[model samples]
Target: MNCEVYKGSRKEGAYLFVADSKSLENLPAALTEQLGDLEFVISFDLATRTSLASADPAEVMASIKTGGFYLQMPPGKDLETC
Candidate 1:
């Protein structure tokens, strides 16, 4: 799947990945408010990776498929933001 990653302004090392970088409005209001603003970081294909630096590629892809986006929080902050 084609994926785009975005950095969140409210927290360092946090990112949001989605299929369409242009439609950030589709994100949940709570999530959008928690993250503050988003900045485009990079884009990649899921078929190209076995794993990501911090998240599992398959898990990330699955989250994007089901949730419309996947949140990657920095290290221990994963459970806190959601």
Candidate 2:
């Protein structure tokens, strides 16, 4: 698995690249363990044109305040190099 994280306007959001679907399924757990101090939520794709997975920035931050984290992995590069 390959993962990179960037600080959002309010909290930490991670972008993950998994080699396959199986890896993707396990991503949440992997991230949770990696981000020891912070709480992690679901992953989002910024590049997504649809609103299916869209999340409010304020809500994301709010979740973090409660010890939860949010993740976003837009479609682009492969996890191998990311």
Candidate 3:
């Protein structure tokens, strides 16, 4: 399956993947509002990838198939609490 990817302005390295280039229409208004302005990144084929930077390719594909979108977030940084 192929998908169009978009980067979130609110968070670094955060991405939203959709099955179709026009699939952004299906996203909730709240989500888009939270994600801020989305920057077009690159198109990708899920079948050709085994894994993404911080997301499982298969899982992302599955989500796209079922939910029409998948959000990829950056790895969490370790925090020290006193």
Candidate 4:
């Protein structure tokens, strides 16, 4: 599926992937707080990705499928790695 990627202002190397810009409005409150400001990075076809630098494609798809968004935390942080 097509998706947009946003980087969290409060964390380095952290990324938030959503179905579209509209999805940002539907993110959970706690998640928004944790992520702080968001900066649009890039938009791409997620359905064609086989691998990512810091996250598993299948897991990211699962989150996006269930939550309408995916939080890709850095290699080591407070939450689970995306």
Per-residue lDDT for 1-82 in model 3, tens only? 9988998776666789998778998898877877788899999788999777877899999999998899876666311110
Better of 2 and 4 by TM-score: 4
RMSD of each: 1.9, 12.7, 4.4, 2.5
Between candidates 2 and 3, the TM-score winner:
3
Stronger candidate by lDDT (1 vs 2): 1
- List runs of model 1 lying over 4 Å from the truth: 79-82
TM-score of each: 0.88, 0.27, 0.84, 0.86
Which lDDT tens digits does candidate 1 get at residues 1-82?
A: 9999998788778889999876587888888877888889998898689989998999998898888998888776663553
Q: Between which residue pairs do clashes occur in model 1?
A: none
Off by over 4 Å in 2: 1-29, 32-54, 75-82
Alpha carbon RMSD to native, model 2: 12.7
lDDT of 2 by residue, 1-82 (tens): 1222332232233342222233334446655455434333334442332233444555444444343444553445222322
What are the lDDT scores of the predictions, listed in order?
0.84, 0.37, 0.81, 0.84
**Candidate 1: RMSD to truth:** 1.9
Q: Report how far residue 38 has shifted in candidate 4, in Å.
A: 0.6
Candidate 1 — worst ten consecutive residues by lDDT sum?
A: 73-82
* TM-score for predicted model 4 compared with the true structure: 0.86
Question: The CA-based lDDT of model 4 is what?
Answer: 0.84
Residues 8-78 of candidate 4 have per-residue lDDT tens digits of 87777778999899999999888887778999999988889999788778888888889899887765675
